[model samples]
Target: YEEPLTGEQYRKLELGPAPIDFDNTIQSLETQSKIVKLEVHYHGHPQERFISLDEPDVSLLSARQLEVINETLERLSSMNATQISAFSHQDMPWKATEDKEIIDYELVFYRDPLTSVREYE
Candidate 1:
């Protein structure tokens, strides 16, 4: 996708690229009762799970945007956190960025074949 789903800037963290405002955004959503955060142990490790209390307002997104979101979720749903991080680390946007620096969204256009979303003719 040429355009990002949101305007949030993602930072190149040690694990991978992550949204800088993720924690604050999650806290706000939880406070608003839009979602619930649960602490759960998975494979002897503690993990945070979010359960949505209400359906999303799909009216806010275009059909193409929704399709991209769904496709991305479907592709990633099978992976565990570690696997997802590893997968993200291989992308050019994450690899090219300096540690703790904001990753440029335009780097998506230069992604390697394995991590590329678009097919070239």
Candidate 2:
């Protein structure tokens, strides 16, 4: 997608690029009873899991946005966290940003073919 599906800004971190407000957003959703958060241990590391209490209100998203989101999920679903992080680190947006800095969404336009989702004429 040309634009981000959500307004949340992503930051370049040591692991990869991640939405800065992800934890807060998830907490808010949990508080609102829209979802439930579970803490679990994975390979001796603490991990968080969220379960939705109700269906998401997709009315806010355009058809193209929904399609893009689904396609992205499908593409990444098979990858584990470590692999996904490594993949994201190779993208221009993450590569161009300094550690702890906010990644520029516009950098996506300059992505290399392997990381780019759109075709250029």
Candidate 3:
């Protein structure tokens, strides 16, 4: 089995506060009258977590981050895994683990998207 869960993971298992910059963007988007189409948050199993930051401002995804997120999404799009498993599931080419468990999903905004969210002002 994977290494035991770290104390930090056991501590809260909650979606920690987003990066300061991301917080600013979220605020800005909310202020601009942009409606949030989808706002979902989730936690991964032992070592991973993510957040789905979907909105009109989604265009703000950076190239690298976009690639990673989209790739996982693409794989998920092709499967019938649970909401949590689909996104954080790491099985590929060949199966690895038999136990299927939900993992934490943490969205990181430290990296800016290739495109910027259009400012409304």
lDDT of 3 by residue, 1-121 (tens): 1122121221111231123244456567666645343434435433322333544354665565566556656645664335434333322201221232222222221212322222225
Candidate number achieving the greatest lDDT relative to the actual structure: 1
Model 2 agreement with the true structure over 69-109: per-residue lDDT tens digits: 88888888999899998999889999889999999889989
Model 2 spans with C-alpha error above 4 angstroms: none
lDDT of 1 by residue, 9-78 (tens): 9999988888999999999999999999899999999998999999989999998888878888888899
Worst 10 residues of 3 by lDDT: 4-13
RMSD of 3: 14.6
Best-to-worst lDDT order: 1, 2, 3
Which whole-number lDDT from 0 to 100 does residue 117 have in model 2? Answer: 74
* Cα distance off (Å), candidate 3, residue 103: 14
**Candidate 3 error regions (>4 Å):** 1-25, 37-63, 77-82, 85-121
lDDT of 1 at 32: 96
lDDT of each: 0.90, 0.88, 0.35
Taking every candidate in turn, the Cα RMSD to the unseen true structure, in Å, is 1.4, 1.5, 14.6
Better of 1 and 2 by lDDT: 1
* lDDT for residue 32 in candidate 2, whole number 0-100: 93
